[model samples]
Target: MHQQSAGQLPAEVLAAFQDEQQQLDAAGIPAGVATVGSVMPDGDLLDAHGEPTTLTAARNGRPAVVVFYRGAWCPYCNIALRAYQEQLQPALATRGVALVAISPQTPDGSLTMQQTKELTFTVLSDAGNQIARRLGILTAPTEPVRQAQAALGLDLTTVNADHTPALPMPAVALVDTAGVLRWIDVHPNYATRTEPAAVLAALTTLD
Candidate 1:
């Protein structure tokens, strides 16, 4: 899932990318999110409509598949999201499970994403990365990456709800009906995502 944009990068630009990946690798996975049986943390976020929503309310005795993505500007995120909507969402629906996607983007960005992708499930704006911070999956972009983003006209400050230059590692959590986390997958590489088939198999185990 390497970025198509990366194919045309010059030598210096590729060096910068390598440097950024090194920084991210050094940061590693957060200890808090490493456990499997932990309870999913509750947090307040805004839906695409700007209405306040909570994780607990969404769970409500039903299993849930919570996905954390970078944002709408990311092509990889878009591909993964569409895959979830077309494949995983339908399977989850049959089992009475809810599928939700969260990002640091503002409500407007979330709305744009929902409309652009024609996603029927919930898309929430996790302003200030409150949920990611709580889950210990929060990460800030390296300076080189930030420079690259700015050069590419991707001003995350304008798109993000809090104007913070941070993002969560792409992740998925499968929560049981009781709200306990049954499965978790966090990808350090933004280009990678949890496969819909893998998620479906995990959900099957919760039965």
Candidate 2:
């Protein structure tokens, strides 16, 4: 079942996200997310409130530290998201950076995620995996992984309601004020994520 707010996050789902959180080891800047995207893609995702928002509009006049997650259904993605909520935003803002999160879930699911994680930044909804594929980070889950997720009680049936069943590979990108890509970070495994400390350092380097 799909939820419209985070408060409705089933205990099992919350626990799953948290467990995925524990698997992270503060990945360094050069490890996984080092592959730079050739060009930044233009796309829009609805905010948690179900309002349409363009990526360009969200990055207005400031650099943006963007993180793309699968959806509320994924445990590992949420763990990475929680890390951003707790550490990345403040550090990035001090440097005139905006924090934006993208997901292929609907607006209702996005809201559920925000409430579930107490996220402080923008959570944009990309109902179709359109934007995700554009950045070259989206991928379909393996059959085994899908089966495991289903057995674990995750309901992906509705998360990817738009068509393609795709998710971002726990990726992060630092975009400059001019909306150009300064750096890109992505992990092949869903269980790992970018370290906030490393991201802070990378943001400074972009200066």
Candidate 3:
């Protein structure tokens, strides 16, 4: 993705992203973040139609793979989600595991992503980063990156439901039928993602 973007995006924009990646790598995952065996927190979320929902409702008594992304405006996020829709959803469905994608973006953004990606899995709006905060996966673009985003005509304050630049670090959590988190992977850098194959392998370790 970086290789392709290098040919298309401005040099300053690329530099800003690279700088953020370096900073994130240096900081690493924050302390006290939720870990395996933790009970996943339930929180209010919005469906594609702006209707109220929750993680529990989305799971519907089935084990679930919960994905937290930055927003629909992120190309990296769109790529990962589209891949999950194509590669992960079908395999997970066979195992009776629900696949859900959540972001701090508005319901409108969620709807657009779902339709544009033709994603059959549940896409939700995590207003105010409720679940992400509890899971300790939340982060925000740096000032330099935010400026770069504005240059590209993207204003996260308006794109996100929380009206802030805050976003959840791209992360995935595997929760069991009883709502207990079995495995999790958090990426401090927004450019990277957890592969479906890794998640499938993690599932094998569960009961």
Candidate 4:
């Protein structure tokens, strides 16, 4: 996926991105990450309009496929989200499941991502990645990668709601109406994501 834009990036920036991917692959999923049967944590979030909301509110008593992505500035995130909107959303709707995508980006950024992707599902802003932290899916770019991102005109400080470089490892969690996590897939490597098919298959296991 990075190859698509590699030609456009400086050599050093591309190398930095590769190094980050290697480190993530070696580290694997973080220890103590939320597992199936655990209660999914609810946290304060901002809707695309910047209105206060919560994970439970967005779920509205329905089973939900909760997505945690880096932000609108991430090309891989955009691709994954667009795929979810097109493929996963309709399938989830048929099963009475809600699809919600959360990011640490500001409300405006969330709004832009939804608008740009023409997404119909709920998009929320986790001001400080409160839910992500509790789920143990938190990650941040390495220093070299951060510098590379800056070279590409991406600034996490201004792009993120918390004004920090923190981000969630791209993840998908299936939560039943009871707030129990049915399944979870975490990708420490930012370039990879939970495929729509994988998420739908997991939904079949939910009671």
From the highest TM-score down, the ranking of the candidates is 4, 3, 1, 2
Residues 142-206, candidate 3: write the lDDT tens digits. Answer: 99999999999999999989899989999999999999999999999888999989988888856
2 versus 4: better TM-score goes to: 4
For residue 16, model 2's alpha carbon misses the true position, in angstroms, by 15
Please give the lDDT score at residue 36 for candidate 1: 76
Regions of model 2 farther than 4 Å from truth: 1-38, 111-117
Candidate 2: tens digits of C-alpha lDDT, residues 125-145: 877766667666766665544
Error of 2 at 87 (Å): 1.5
**What would the TM-scores of all predictions be?**
0.89, 0.77, 0.96, 0.97
For candidate 4, which ten residues in a row score worst on lDDT?
108-117
Residue pairs with backbone atoms closer than 3 Å in model 2 (clashes): 5-112, 6-112, 6-116, 33-185, 33-186
Q: Which stretches in model 1 have alpha-carbon errors above 4 Å?
A: 1-3, 8-11, 22-27, 111-117
- The superposed Cα distance between candidate 1 and the true structure at residue 168, in angstroms, equals 0.9
lDDT at 41, model 4: 92
Report the C-alpha displacement of residue 142, candidate 3, in angstroms. Answer: 0.9
Which structure among the candidates has the greatest lDDT?
4
Candidate 3 stretches greater than 4 Å from native: 111-117
lDDT of 2: 0.69
Q: Tell me, by TM-score, which candidate is best.
A: 4
